[model samples]
Target: MRLLFLAVLRPHTGNAVTAQRVRAHLEAAGHVCVLKDAFDFESPSEIANLILAENFEAALALHLYRGGRLLQGHRIPFGVIFGGTDVNEDANQRDKNTVMGRVLEEARFAVAFTESMKEMAHAQWPHAKGKIYVQSQGIATTPNAAFNWNTFLQRSEINQSADNLHIFLLICGLRQVKDPLYLVDAFSEWHQEEPNVYLVIVGPEVDPVFTREVKAKVKRSPGVRLIGEMPQEDLHAVVKNCFVVVNSSVSEGMSAAILEAMDLEVPVLARNIPGNAAVVKHEVTGLLFSNPQVLVLSAKRQNDRIAYSCLGA
Candidate 1:
């Protein structure tokens, strides 16, 4: 079977990663998959032309509004995998919500990364409840041995020793929904007290206006630096070296960053949003913070624990 896979294929974005993974799985199962970026085409007819040209048997879209909107009016059967923003952000919009509802109504199947996400979709579009399936993405990490920590720190203009630095790596695309600046003030204040501590924000620049604001904020902020984007392979190594992984997004479906941190055995400090709370068990797998102050306090407490443990040994 030949399938057309549609997603927002922005570089270093989660939707692109998920689309590639799905394509790999379909191909492994002996199906041919044609992957395309939903943004490349303007209308349903444009998508129809591609589908007809490729002779695709089925279609798979990553986001309801961003990707699924294009899959509409096509004769071929299609499934939609919920993007984080679709449920967390766009569902609140009157026009977008209506379009999403229609998309789900016509979709042969749907996927949610977590049970809570599935429940949210069901509440919004109860008619498609049975067709909505929950499937957590499979994650695996392998850090490259050749990655040089000192070189990365130098290139990122971070002045600290690897042994003493308590680096918190916050990974997210530079967009408003991510709220990458949420903990900037708290982390900066904490840094004044603890000179060895640093908070690094790394990801692609998705919003130029927001990116400019973040860069300006980082310029004035101490111990907080925006590294923009790093290659995925190098990022895994950077994640491994960090003292803690952070997620300060205002909303999320299921953050690949949090999961990747857990998989890499790096401690995580995530915003206490429902999506994050679902994945992180407080004081167990990782810590969840309701606000910047809470996050700062939690990090301090965790650091104290580590200090005590080292002294005891």
Candidate 2:
């Protein structure tokens, strides 16, 4: 079987990881797999021509609305994988909902990263109930050896000797749906009360306007560190060294960052939303907070009680 996998690749992000995983899986199983970064194309017609040329047995699209439309227009037998924003946020919009609805209708099968996402899919598109499938996104293979803590801290500008400093690492591309600025306001208050506690925002700034806003907020908040984006290896190393990993997205499918933190045995402090709640089992792997106050309070409590070395927090 010749399979064509399509997605917007961010070099080393979740969508890229998913695309690579699918391609590797299919190829390892004796199928021909080709990966196409849809975002690189100038037009949909070009994408259609490329897919037609591939003579693919089947196609797998990462985002429902974007990738589905391209494959569907080409009359391809394709499957749609829901991204965090697709079900949690985009489906709420009138125009995006219509586009996503059509994609769901045309897909041979639709995949959700978590069981909660599977339920959301059914609720959103009841007519396509039979086609929805729940698939856990597998974590990347762990590094061969333990990460160097001192090297990672030095590169990320983290001070290891600051016993009072409670570092919360938030990793996500700069986008409106990610609510990247949520931590800015929260960090301001936390910074005033607990001078040593700092919130670090990491990830690429994909959206210009949103990136500008995030930069502006970062300038105002001394405690909030917006480190733009780091390489995948560096990002993973930083996640392993942070006091706790944070996710405050307004929407998510199943955050790859949250899962990576869990896999690395790092404690996650995420927003109390469906996508995040599904991964970070509250009080077990990490704590989920709906608002800034709750997050700050929880972080303080966790910091006081739990030793970072105990569970690699």
Candidate 3:
């Protein structure tokens, strides 16, 4: 099979990871894949022309609207992979909903990262119910546990302490849907009570306005550390050392970061959104919280338990 995979690429992000995974899977199965970054094209017509030029047997798109539109316009047998914002947040808008609905209608198959996401697509577009498929996003190669922690801490400015310090890592590109500042006020209050607890926000500032807001909030809250995006391998190594991984996104398809933490055997603390709930089994794989207080308390308890268990071993 000759496949064409399309997505808006970033330096280090989940969408990039998804596109890479699909390409890998197809290639490993003895199929040829032509991967293209949709954002690189100046216009959608360029993307359409590229797809037509490749004579692709099948097309796979990451976002429902942009990627879907390009491929669908070419009358290709394409698949739609819903991104976090598309089904959860973007679908709420009238124009986006219509675009997504049309994409879903024309798609040969619609892939979602989680079961909940599949359900959302079904409910959103009942006409395309039978086409939805759920596949767990693959994690890239796991990090070897041989990295120099001392050097990493020095480079990242991460304080290495096991006594009373609790670090919660939230990794996501700064965007409105991520709601990076949701826990800022709560983190400040918690920091006052437990000076040792720290929240680290790590990811590239994809949106300048949102990134500026996040930076402004970080300035006011000393407990929050805003480390912009790090390399994928480096981020995985950091996840291994952290006490707990955290996510507070307003919407998600399936949190690749949370899944990466689970794959690395690091516990997770995530928001109670459907995507997060699908990954974190609540007290099993990780903890989920609807309120800020619950998130803080559950995160602390889970972090302590994980730490004690590690020490005992």
TM per candidate:
0.95, 0.88, 0.90
Model 3: ten consecutive residues of lowest lDDT: 304-313
Residue 128 displacement in candidate 3 (angstroms) = 0.4
Better of 1 and 3 by TM-score: 1
Clashes of each: 0, 2, 0
Ranking of all candidate structures by their TM-score, best first: 1, 3, 2
Instruction: Extract clashing residue pairs from model 3.
Output: none
**Which candidate leads the pack in TM-score?**
1
- Writing each residue's lDDT as its tens digit, candidate 1 over 1-313 gives 9999989999888888888888999999999998999999888999988988889899999999999999999899999999988998899999999999999999999999999999899988888979999999887787887999988888777885634788889999999989999999999999889878899999999999999999999999998988868778889999999888889989888888988887887788889987998888777777778989987886677674632322232
Candidate 3 regions exceeding 4 Å error are: 41-44, 144-146, 154-162, 300-303, 306-313
Which sections of candidate 2 miss by over 4 Å? Answer: 40-48, 73-75, 141-161, 306-313
lDDT tens digits, residue span 11-53, model 3 = 6667887888778888999999888887776665786777678
lDDT of 1 at 22: 86
Rank candidates, lDDT, best first.
1, 3, 2
Q: Give me the displacement of residue 113 in model 1, in angstroms.
A: 0.5
Return the top candidate by lDDT. 1
lDDT of 1 at 84: 84
The TM-score of predicted model 2 comes to 0.88
Report the poorest 10 consecutive residues by lDDT, candidate 1: 304-313
